[model samples]
Target chain A: MLLEKLQSAVGAGVILPDGHETFVLNLGPQHPATHGVLRVKLTMDGEYILRAEPVPGYIHRMQEKMGENRSWSKYLPNTSRIDYLSAMTYTHAYVLVVERAAGIEVPPRAEYLRVITSELNRISSHLVWFGAFLLDLGGFTPLLYAFDDREKILDLLESVTGSRLTYCYYRFGGLCNDVDAEFLTGAREFVAYMRPRLAMYRQLVTDNIILRKRLEGIGRIDAELCRKYGATGPVIRGAGVANDVRRVEPYSVYPLLDFKIPVYSECDCMARYLVRMDEMEQSLRIVEQAIAQLPEGPVMGKVPRVVKVPAGDYYHAVEAARGRFAIRIVSDGKEIPYRIKLRTPSFSNLSLFEEASRGMMLPDALALMGSLDLVIPDIDR
Target chain B: MTPTLDELNQAFLRLLTPAPALGTACEMHDATSCEGKGVSPNPAPTPPPTSAPVPPCRIVEGKTKGYHFDADLAPDQIVPAGRLLDERGFAIDAVTGVDWLAAGQMEIVYDFYHPVSVLHVVLRCRVPREGAEVPTLSEVFPGANWHERETHDFFGIRFTGHPDLSPFLLPEDADYHPLRKDFTGAA
Candidate 1:
């Protein structure tokens, strides 16, 4: 049926020298360039793609269904599972909606701690993206460097959160636990250590002509396209729109901290690449400032014993590693939520691939996909 | 030129203002009736019977509420709302359904965020649970294609005029909608 729609839109095919027409090529569900089990059914006319339809849902966990079944507090652990790459931010978004609905006041110290940990997580997420993305583009060394830096962040986070990957660190009103002085000192040292590494990464990967040729002027997505598809975070930032949720929507203690939303108007893969690279530096800055201005107070907020959110709907979004990760909760003034929608950014970001990758070379299209910094579990959720 | 939250709020009000005679009666009609009623059966249009003010279809500014501007719109009003918000440079965030099973109604919620400003606009419309359907916003906001399909997958809500409503995040051949309150996992 997708083929019929494509055929109706762009004829049956372009006759090749070999007398064959455009044929369908299933790209993933298990391919390295995809980064996960994301399949793209590409109707290829030789090396160029006529259309690229991403077949998602290879890992649908019914995350939203679980939200309805479980009690409000019981669903906290599931938030991290939606997007493992940036579990803290995803958890923060879920925690926020419930807090707002229940009228729970998170303490100032907890807010600052949330900001510090989230920014550190963002840097780690970006580092993984930086490495995996470079690896996707055929540069393996950066992944090693990227994970090395990322490992330090994981260690710091693990000291507080306990788990390394799918972190259920954030609680209803505040965080699961308070960050001690040792964790704070480790974060500060990690930030200082990461600054020069970013410069080195720019020298090693961004300066390379091969990566430049692979990314520059390839898979160019403008601001209008982003708005149409609701593509957020670095994708929109790379398109020159400073739509960062932290800056635009003053959630957490972000309004108190000063940071620049790295926007590049070039709207190419390179622009998206450069945006993520610069964002890590900016995350380091926020982590640095947040630590220095860290308040002396309690991390956990006062709350009722049995959590029952009021009968109303609430929406809260946080700047996750991929984009603006949002959560919409419909409560029935009961312990269990009526409905919960986890709006993962990659879901929206990946939706744009079909339209954006039209008529582009397969390699360039994959480069564009890598630039999207997709976590397939997030999209599949 | 990023419009401030106030500007966007005012713009939404101006767009949603009742068009004199063409008031809220249009809310009850389904998509087929709304589309077919382009050529009204009655040649001479009669003035709306009720002088009682149109309910708050306008955007409600609420800092306490999760969204800055929350409006309960009629099912038919979603497309125009989408167009107005789209023109105002608001990006389509997410579209999902809420099942008020006890009320025998299903509510479709559309969340929109301004790319340049600090505003989250939520548009919600309720329809009867049996044979639930709403006009597609995929034409207005292409990003809504997957969202609408996912909503359909979970709640069995049909998005009329959706290019392809093939099951998203569900098996293509799957016949069950799992997220409905009464859905039993018997199969």
Candidate 2:
């Protein structure tokens, strides 16, 4: 009898016993580390997972339909809600789309400010991922240690932007407010303080032999599949595709600022982890450049208060911390958009995990998942 | 990246070959009080309205690009164009269906994001209050399966042939779609 263990419905009882000598196992939708509310039915033989089926849609919020009723400027705030961790980066992409749709021009100062906040948000997202990744692997202390620096970053962000977790800072044409002098000085201090501390994150767990054994070759995706699945950010970079939207499709103040995208040939867990860590460093460099070259000008663009973009279609994507976050707006020559859609990276990138998780042991599979850096709220929304 | 208003004004003027109906296009400088209802800052050619019935299309206005007719698609046109777009390397970003209860109509928009050209196409199809069904895009973009289901969950539009059209965001066996205008909040 091949019995299947129902992942979330423990009360409904496990599926018939695999009586296959091996056994079927129930993972979790409730278990703290399934990312968020995801239940998976795994057919296992002894310790190796034979077939791992991911049953998603547990958190599907019809995000697109809501955009239809709202006006273009109103849609900007929704971006931050989708990905709470990378709030600034998410809105950065969204504001660009709205600006393009409405034909608004942001000043040079606004662009630099956008870059600075966006990069800061990237680093912040990576830090949380780093801590959560280690925690998933069963380490507790690093979670606290990582948060120490993260708290400082969040405090800095909150001071200027107003919110900590879900920030809606970027305005349509430009930012909501110009960065004050004290805010800039504090940002510089935070960067200087965190630079050397990152070395500890590198040396402590990333370089450990046991961690390497778990991450090095567990879940391997070839370069070809990466492109096919439209994987972006560190995941695609792990597969050696040097397609960073900042470079390919320059938006905001990215063209004026200088930064490097790190890509590794190894399409495995270590490669992704290393890529994320290096990206944090690159983001720091962007912060420095923007701060040094911070220009003086208005923060908001000359966008109409009630933006009625002439009936047209406009698409814009920004390289967020996770991947390319895109917005597509179709206006019907009305106050509201005929249609609005968000192209999120997590949904596409995380879809690859089901294919990648087969054959690996349960622990190795968890490690591979940690490397993917999924923010399920974003996925669900 | 968006073309500046100035650049758009130029492009729109060029697109207007003969000239606008009002001799010149107007810009709704104060849109907050009024709809940017005026022609535009950029003068463009406005095709004279013909006796032909305006079926499923919207008026297209662009700052730089000339104003033209944008097809507000019918179900028949939507299915094929969706496949063509998916085949042409545009990834499905979202499948949205909006219900205008007061207006007695529902609009379904399939938002497609193409990476190569970095262009987004919003293909819209509307269904009457009686029968709202759009041929499935699930076969074309596998990612659309959940989206269509979600649309069904909200707007009450049936996406026939959707492999698993269960209530995704809502509870199991819930008769009403919470997103529908008629629905009275979370029941």
Candidate 3:
């Protein structure tokens, strides 16, 4: 019966035609559409997916488990790995939760530094999302185009944080290094430099009707449905819900930066595209503001050589490029956290795919998955 | 002055803000304490040090003392933290289940954010170790279904009314809450 059900889902036959009835296909642990080591077992009826079941844990590093072993300070690195593309945002969530629990007041200058770097990280993330989203849609050119500008932001971040991908630059109190005046000036110049490029992105992708036909209404997540599933980032905003972690709960220098959280109410794939495209521009503006008012101060707070957060729970969320990133940390009066739980935005956002994809074509489903903009590690974690 | 989450919390307490069950969380403290992410409050009056220590309770029957957070909702409590979080403008980020073997018991943590409030609220409900169960919030927040499913998958806890309780990020019959202290199982 199980085999028959699987076969029917595959749609070849409830009974075998040539000994074997089902067209079982594994859309793999490495397939581009699988989004990084995700294996979705698809029992198919020709090109149509009859049954699609997701398989996770291929790269399950057990970050939450690792938090139990490492102290609060030692576990920050783990955040970067969950959604490596949005590492800084993950670490920001980690540090902020500690700050809230322990009452560590991050100074004004520190907040500006955080904003400059985080916004740059946001730009870097969106650039990748933009490129990758397009790449998924079958146009490979935009990937490289998005990366060119992303390199600039990456270089700027590398100057301060020292590493590109899994940066452990943020301390509970401040940054690991100060923002040099030259770096500050360069960051300011870069944002000013990238202004028109964003408009170009709109023309190249956002305004393209062909792209719209592929995305526009392909994955229509209604406003009520979005909230029901706890979607965030552009997915929720696209549904006409004005909910952004940065705007709703202002953190760092965001309250001072004077940038609007872009929200589009269309609740479709195209709406998500527009929301993300507009957000990158808003991120640039925030980065510019931070560099303009870049106050002079020590980048690292007066933290002891070995950082130790006191006992009790600390939960903090950051507006990652994708959505709200909530980190719940419990320290056992040690350097590491007794327990650390990451509430990744991508995981929840991706769930909408199940509802949004029902009764949709395979291409439409892919479009819906792409539009959700989730990184699997974030989901698996 | 732009208000922060800390200021909001203080105002909530002063105005007798009903201890609703959810709020937003942030990674960085914005401008000042007022704008940081959601933080569970300590019962003590004074703010604790960054490295403040909590003594681990002696292992009583292989478990620590479980604390109950029964924050009674006032009858006219207009903003029941849980309902408002899903009804109007809030976006649920992630739901967390905190299992404290050292302190004992488990805390079901819900993080919520309203774009305009500029406030993040964290609501945590507690359940004991032997039979941990909570009402499914999936009926309220569709996103909670995934979170609740993942929590059920990893922690091996049951959400009594969860519509679908299959393993989301785990193998169908895998038996291990990898996040639990005694977990060694995997898919």
Candidate 4:
């Protein structure tokens, strides 16, 4: 019955082949491997996947409609909730769009602070991805190590943001609150501590023969496939396209700061893993530079009590941990946006799973999904 | 050397215009002009006290630097324009729908970004509110498939020729589009 439904939904010509006995496997709106409420309907022929379709939307919250219903400033909390793992990036993107549309100038100090917090948040998100990806590969120890580092970062962020996971710290012109000396020192110290730990991680996991055997050259996605599927972040970088939004479309203090985008041409699970590992180090460098060049000014900029965007459409894209996090706002000279569209990278990135997993073994397909680093809520939102 | 923004703009104008020889007369209204009139082609029924005079329709600089190209294409012209952009190496970044309730229209916004040249083009088209329909760009850039589906799920704008316009970020059995301006869900 499920196969018949899938056939009618996806079309008989595309999913099923002639004379091939295949059974459909529902991978879950609840399975542990998916990491969230995401279900992948897999057409399997004895342990090999003939076709895969990801069924998202278990956590759809109508975030865009919420944006229209609420006031301009009231929508900040929803941004973070979309992708809790890298909440800062989402908040930053939302704030930046509103700022640009309203012509609110952020102080240089605020810009630096935003970059520092956002990069730190990137590191925390990558740590979670690292932990979860390894757990998917059956290595339980790495999750502990990854979380150990993630908790410290979260603590540092919580000191200012007031919440650990779904942070709503960024305001339109600046942050909700200012960061103090302790946060800066803790960030710098974390950078120093994390640099060596990355090497330890390399020694412990990246170099392990069994891990390499599992990940290397499995689930290859070349550049063309990435372009077709609109895959971004590590998935595209692993395919040798250095397409980081911070670099391609530089925003805030990223252009002023110096860092390298890690790109690998192998286009496999291992390549994606290495790209993310390298990205965490790059994010560390950004955090270090932002701390070193910290500016002094009022963190919050002057703005009207009631924010009204000039009647126009605006687009702003920021590099979130997962990929290009873009916000499109259409305003009609009102406090509430007429329309709000969140161009989440995870949605585009996760769409590639169907094309990427075809003809691969079930375990290898799961590995590929892990390397994609999906945060399901983001996709559904 | 890559083409300059002006050259790209001119090329886009040439491609989108029904006839290149018609020139400036055939140019669509600038996005700012449409904005001044409250995102409608027609003037607002009752202008607000502070409403500024509408500007002429022409290509103008966007607020964000490097985002130089902004235009409103007719619904019929979007597919050809999208194909031109795809040929020029601009990837589809996002596709979204907007509800212009007062104007009684639904708008589709397509954002395309050129990786190397650092150019961002925003293409917008509007359809009637009751039954919105727009051409699908999934063939030009396959990434648009999911985006179109999401837009459909939100606004109920049907994408002609899309292989699968199934529910994306909504429950499969959802009967009503939630993002339309009129949808006042279980309040």
Off by over 4 Å in 3: A1-26, A41-53, A332-334, B1-91, B102-104, B119-122, B184-187
**What are the per-residue Cα lDDT tens digits for candidate 3 across B1-187?**
2334444444434423333321211111110121121123432222433452221111111011111111212222213445644544555656777665433445566666554454445555555545777777776677788788888877766787789878767766766677776776554
Best-to-worst ranking by lDDT = 1, 4, 2, 3
Candidate 2, residue A59: Cα displacement in angstroms equals 5.2
Ranking by TM-score: 4, 1, 3, 2
Candidate 2 TM-score over all chains jointly: 0.76
Cα DockQ of the candidate 3 complex: 0.24
Q: Go through the candidates in order and give the clash count of each.
A: 0, 12, 32, 1
Which prediction has the highest lDDT against the true structure?
1
Of the two candidates 2 and 4, the one with more favorable DockQ, higher being better, is 4
- Predicted candidate 2 versus true structure: per-residue lDDT over B1-187, tens digit per residue: 3223344334323433233321211111111101232223333433354454332333444332221222345565556666555555555656666554434556676765444343445566656655788788877665677668767877778887778777765666767776665666565
lDDT of 2 by residue, A139-236 (tens): 87778888888898898888888989778888878888877898899889878987888888778888888788888987886554554455677887
lDDT of 1 at A53: 90
Model 1 steric clash pairs: none
Each candidate's TM vs. the true structure?
Answer: 0.91, 0.76, 0.79, 0.91
Give the docking tier of candidate 3. acceptable
| Predicted structure with the largest TM-score when compared to the true one | 4
Alpha carbon lDDT of residue B40, candidate 1?
A: 35
For all candidates in order, the CA lDDT equals: 0.84, 0.69, 0.69, 0.84
Off by over 4 Å in 1: A1-20, B1-54
| Per-residue C-alpha lDDT of model 3 across residues A1-381, encoded as one tens digit per residue | 996686567555433464545466777788887668877666655565556666666776777887877666777777788898888888887777777666677777888887778888888888888888888899888899889998988888788778888888788888777777778888888888788888788888888878988987778898767766767788888888777877766667787778887778788888888888888889888888777787877766666567666665555667898887877666656665666778788777877666666556677777787888878888887
Candidate 1: tens digits of C-alpha lDDT, residues B1-187: 6556667667656655664413442343221121112213342433353555434344443454667776556667789889988878889999988876655668788999989888788887778788999999999999999999999998999999999888878888888999998997827
